[model samples]
Target: MALRGTNQEFGRPYNRRIVLETIRLEAPIARGDIARQVGLTVQTVSTIIRELELQGFVMGVREAPKGRGLPRTNLTLNPEGGFAIGLHVTPIGVSAALVNLAGKIVGTRHHPMARVSPEATFPVFQALIAEMQALRPKGRMLGIGVAMPGPSDVDSMSFVGPTTLEGWKGVPVRDRLAEAHVLPVFAGAELGAVALGERLYGVGREFRSFYYIYFGVGLGGAAVQDGTVQRGAHGNAGEIGHLPLVPGGDPCPCGNRGCLERYVSRDALDRRLKAVDPNATIETALTDHAGVVDAWIDEAAPVLRSAIATIENLYDPETIVIGGLASDALLERLLAATEPLMHSVAERSGRTTPRLTLSSDGQDAVLRGAAALAISGALSPRFGLLFAGEEERAERDPIMTGPSRKEVAA
Candidate 1:
């Protein structure tokens, strides 16, 4: 379980991060407004802003004209302050992107992969990193964030499960990448990465609590509450794909019968489509084989609706975002077909945002999320680090003040 710290342990760093996030979310905002939003005194806000400005993390734009003697200066994030490299590795391919501090993709590249082993995948990662290196100098890149299928053991930095990322079990992905690039490396479950990316850059920015339903080759889910992704004790909190929705329907490699993914994932839809028209590709299924697409949607909708209802009842998130590699047309049809969504706690009145929504980033969600993971690590301050610093200080100065121990003893 994660531990919480007192204000004295984490006050300054936490406040600084909050200030930076406030500026990021409300750019061109005034210092006074930021101070109010973050609950920091104006003097402290000014000090943090000055430090951020000197470090190029934020820039002061022109002052807003008002009746005052001196206009309030607006502050915004410096897009060029830092860059993060994001990589999404999947069974089908690998995608790499360079993202700026402001959550914008500066450059992206995709490479198809026929193999999933470390030997074959590491070279592709190296090549992609080399390409992204051209976008910024070495030191400006905060770190590389990798998103891969889970049940990933975040502590081990390896993909677990017999079927997930075959041949990748026990691989020290973060350490290897860090050694090769001589920079920090962060690895996240694919769904968690997608949620993080959305939280930072997409519709998720508007909602502090939401569930992200990621539809890739398989179905996955991630939940964010109070702006923090709920990474369960083992970082496998959102592995919703294995939810046994249909008790005896189909067998999953995870040793579950009728797993949710078996009914709602891309592969599941593709199988239904291929059964209808042997030649149907994802594109063909949407365009040339509308009937097949409709049939798949019909089969997938109830399962999705039930899953959504379960997620809502459990998490009580403000919204549920459906995103991943699924096409917009397919997602629209699925949404439309799933109507009258199952009643849940989300059905309450005065709901500002829709209970169900499509992902704004679409196919690039995981890749962008990988980048956001790196950005979060580089920018966010954690309670553990603050406490550790306090411990180190205590070790250096064991007591407040005193005469020599021998003199006192004498």
Candidate 2:
């Protein structure tokens, strides 16, 4: 269970988010079953369901299963209830999608981008927003979510690499986007967004906590703990690439030596392939130069294995996933090369999920995840948000509004 609900009236706001999350995950479910799963009373579920129905966020369907005792009213999230715009900012291009409350992408548009400054991106974002609004004319406009490469706001490694997004440190990204679009905006690293996307719509559906390693131009990582992305003090908790693993190893763009990513990332693989054939590219190199690929994998797999052991021992997540921009075959090769992993606490028996696995969300996972950010931020319950101003609560965190001042009578 990703989230659970409370029976107390004081916790009603959080309960609503929990109920909604459960319904979205296991739709066509009876309210009684929802209550049982979320640890809430049936009466509380009914009350929340009533409020949701009144707001058009949920709808009930009466169905009679064959040989059942009675016809049941099962609830499902209303797909048309609301829509959020998901924007994925990459150095090469921007991918935009219109995602609904049901977490489905109903429309999409893409624009090529050579630069990534606010002046360049906001205009493109405006065009895409117009297209998405035209595509779906009636739903509530929830807000916008953006996924971008990170290590932002801190001097230690702020936009320091070619693969990582540059010139983004101290940009106030979320605030700038909100001002540009005049909508609520939430932004985070691509890996965090992908983790959230997986939690909502991908292989992460069953696991409450997991670590995601993203292999794009460079390697990045993120963790979902207690059903939310664990953003650290600088919103860079999962910057696994920069971890110092190998002694006196290759220098990294982040101004560090022996960084894990220098040995195990796409750039590392490309450099190896280029050493053999100057014109080799990742796409054709896998087939045209199998030996080169194997050699690189053999060298990199040990580092990845060590990282996996560290992750398992430290986070103890249910599983660790390999994801992001690489082709499945390449990912499969890395997964295969890293076999017979080093012993760790996760080596314990009775675990249902394998310690190492690959994400099944496909190449567009980041874009889809970017879309999930808005939904997750607005719908996921945050207790501190209960104290936010009414305007902030309703605008930035709709479902997190605290209980009304009026009493709930017996």
Candidate 3:
């Protein structure tokens, strides 16, 4: 006996997406289970599963025995169903990777940027994309996800910060890339991408909420709530580096005094090292100029703890993740130095999660996240449809014939 059709309000496309998301989150499960979890009829789920199978997004793995009934087919996502390219543009270089539907990095390439002008940078991006494409199996390239520095305008696809990439102000990066490659393009800030990547593929899969602190050339952060990165008024929500940590201390380029980045970022460490020994590199300073490193840690750790406590109070994330271009050894030392975390609401008893930890993805978090942005855009349900404009709603509305079980069943 077949079950009834889905309600009219939910629509067919929405129901299909619900089934797909259920399988993605919990795979190798029987079709009956999916129907139950998504609150859809068995016949409806079977139809959707058949369609997904034909489209190569899902496939039946094996038959699971049912008590006193026919064996049920268990389904799982097909990792090779689609692919996405993630490219990150930083002050020093550009990195690109091809990620499959399963969130695996199949190919990667990095190119140094001698100049940040559109003229010079476009070729580098083109070359990296070409290299990644060559490495992946020919399939549907969903889109390209670009991760750029913050203080950016997503609508304009332009960099706005005075200290960010030079000559990139008002540049139409997304449009230019889409035109050049003939593929859809998605753009996000560096920290936003990092947080999204973690949510999809890293420790984020384990926790529903957390704060990501990126330790790159400069400090930055992002807040993830239930697997979605929060993008505030502008596209620049996670500019934690510019947060005022010291009132009457060093002047920051952002016109702020004693900003967090001035004390805790890699650039800050370099500056301190240079002040101590004119010729010390980051590597040498860590090994040779131990006194400077210790001093910097002494000053930076307490402030970082304070910032973590502030994040706990404001955002109340389950855990705080520290990651970026900083070396593993440096990160370890920094995490160690920030020990005995300051008091916060998160310090309550019976807490299963630690207040702070290092990112499992390490330096590749942002690049991986750039790819995730594209993958998520393609597969995730469009909740924005509810708030879509009239034109958008009209364009996206699924065709609704007379609601007949047989018509939908077919």
- Which of the predicted structures, 1 or 3, would earn the higher lDDT when compared with the native? 1
Steric clashes per prediction: 0, 0, 0
lDDT tens readout by residue for model 1, 48-149: 787667556778788767786877679998777767899998877789999988788888999977667788999999999999978664326767899988
Using lDDT, give the best candidate's number. Answer: 2
lDDT against the true structure, per candidate, is 0.78, 0.78, 0.77
Model 3 sits at a Cα RMSD from the real structure of: 6.8
What's the TM-score of every candidate structure? 0.82, 0.81, 0.83
Alpha-carbon RMSD of each model: 9.4, 6.0, 6.8
Query: 169-244, model 2: which lDDT tens digit per residue?
Result: 6677787777766556888888789888988888888788899898876778889887778988877888888888
Q: Which candidate, 2 or 3, would have the higher TM-score against the true structure?
A: 3
Task: Point out where model 2 deviates above 4 Å.
Answer: 1-22, 25-56, 66-69, 107-110, 272-281, 288-291, 381-410
User: Model 1: number of clashes?
Assistant: 0
**The CA-based lDDT of model 3 is what?**
0.77
**To one decimal, what is the Cα RMSD in angstroms of model 2 from the true structure?**
6.0
